[model samples]
Target chain A: MDRQAWTTLFHRLLFTSAVWIVLSGTDAKALAVGAFAVPAATWLSLRLLPGRDRLVLWRFLRHFPSFVGGSLQGGVDVARRAISPGMPLLPGWVEVPVRLPDGGRVALGAELSLMPGTLAAGVRGDRLLVHLLDTDAGFENAIPREEAAIAAMILGTGKEVGP
Target chain B: MNDLATYAFTSIGLFFFVAGSVGFLRFPDVFSRLHALTKADNLGLGFIALGIAFQAESWRLVALLFLIWGLMLLAAGTMSQLIARDALRERDGR
Candidate 1:
C-alpha cells in the first residue's frame, strides 16, 4: 500500500482500538469479541466514508485551537444575551459569496454554525445563506476571516480559488 | 478541592442550560432560538463533562465524555441548519 493508505489504516486502527477499549473496558471476556468486532466495524466505516481527501493533520491541528475558542465564545455570547433583559437580537439573513471549493464550503458552513451568532442556513451556488443573531454583527467581515482559516486548513492556502 | 471544582463546573454548566432555556422562551423567532439552543447546549454539556472529567477514575472516561460531546456538536450543527432552512423557506413563501 502507498504511504497515505498506510497512514489512513494506522489511524483507523488506532481509533477503533480506542473505541473498543472504551466499550469493553477492562473486561477480559469481551476482548475476544472486540478483536473481531473492531476490525469489522473499521472496515465498514472505511468503505462507507472512504478517505478521498488527504486530511492534513498538521494544518488541522494548527486550526483547532481557534475553532474551540470560537465555539466557547459562541456559547457564552448566547448565554449572556439569553439572560439579559434587553435580549438585544436584530436577527436577519445575509448571503455571503465564498471563495472556497465544495469541501471547504461545507466545512466553513459547519464551522460558522458552531460559532457565535452565526447559522449557515443554506447554500446556493457560491453564496452561503447565513442567519445571524444580530444583523449588525459584521458577519461579512468575520465570516471571510473564518473562511480564510478554513480555506487554509483544507486547501493549505487561502489563495487557492476553489472550483 | 476536587469537590469544589466539580461543583463550580457543574453549576456553570447548569447556568448555561438555564440561559438556553430562557433564550428559547424569550427569543423572537425560530432561528434565534436555535442559535441559543445549539451554542448553550455545546458549552453547557462541555462544562458538565469537564466537571465529570475531574472525578473520572480513568482517562478512558474523559475521552468518552469528549466523544459524546463531539457527537452532540455534530447533531446540534445539523439540526440547526435543518430548522433554520425550514424557517427560511416558510418566510420566503409568505
Candidate 2:
C-alpha cells in the first residue's frame, strides 16, 4: 500500500477500535475480541471502499466543535419555531452560487440540510438550490461561512479536480 | 439530583418531539414539514440520549448514546436531502 493508503487504513483501524470499545462498554473480554475484530473489519472496509478522500485529522478536529455547536443551535431554533403559537414561517428557495467542487459541494449541501432552517433542494451547475424555513434567518451569509469551513476541513490543499 | 437532571432532560426531549409533531401537522408543504421533523428530532434525540447517559453506569454507555445521536443526525440529513430533491424534481416537472 502507498503512503496515503496506509494512512487511511491506520485511521480506519483506530476508528473501528474506538467503535468496538464504545459498543462493548469497555469490557475487558470484549476488547480482547475487538483487538482482532476491529483490524479485520478495517481491512475489509478498506477493500470495499478504496481510494477514498484522505481525511485531514487536524482540520476535522478544529471544525468539529463548531459543527456540534451549529447543530445544537439548529435544534433550538427549529424547536422554538415549532412550538410558537404564531408560526412565523416565510418559506422560500434561494440559489447560492458556490465555488467548492462537486464532492465539497455535496458535503456542504448535506451539512446545510442538517441545520435547523435550511434544506438543500438540488444542485444545478455551480449553484445549489437551498430551501429556507425563513428567508429572514440570515442564511445568505451563514451558508457562505459554512461553505468556507467545509472547504477548509474536507477539501484538502484547496484544489478542485472537478465540478 | 440525578433524578431531577434526568427528568429535566427527558422532558425537554419529549417537548421537542411534541413541537416537531405539531410543526409536521401544521406545515403546509413537504419542504417545511421536512424542516420541522429533521431539526426537532435531532435535538429531541440528543436530549434524550443525554438524559439516559446521566443515569448510565459506565462511560461506554454515554459514548454509545452520542454515537447513536450522531448516526441519527447523519441519517436525517441524507433522508431530508433525498426527499427534498425528489420534491423539487416533481415541482419542476409540473
Candidate that would win on TM-score: 1
**Model 2: residues >4 Å from true position, as ranges?**
A26-37, A47-52, A157-163
Give lDDT tens digits, candidate 1, residues A19-69: 888766858778888889889988987886566555567888888898889
- Judge the docking of candidate 2 as incorrect, acceptable, medium or high: medium
Candidate 1 clashes: the total is 0
Output the TM-score of candidate 2: 0.88
> Candidate 1 clashing pairs?
none
lDDT of 1 by residue, B1-94 (tens): 8888899998999999999999999998988898899889888999999998899989888888888888888788877887887888888893
| DockQ of each model vs. true complex | 0.75, 0.66
Q: Which candidate tops lDDT?
A: 1
RMSD of 2: 2.9
List TM-score per model, in order.
Answer: 0.90, 0.88
Regions of model 1 farther than 4 Å from truth: A101-103, A161-163
Positional deviation of B51 in candidate 1, in angstroms? 0.7
Candidate number of the best DockQ: 1
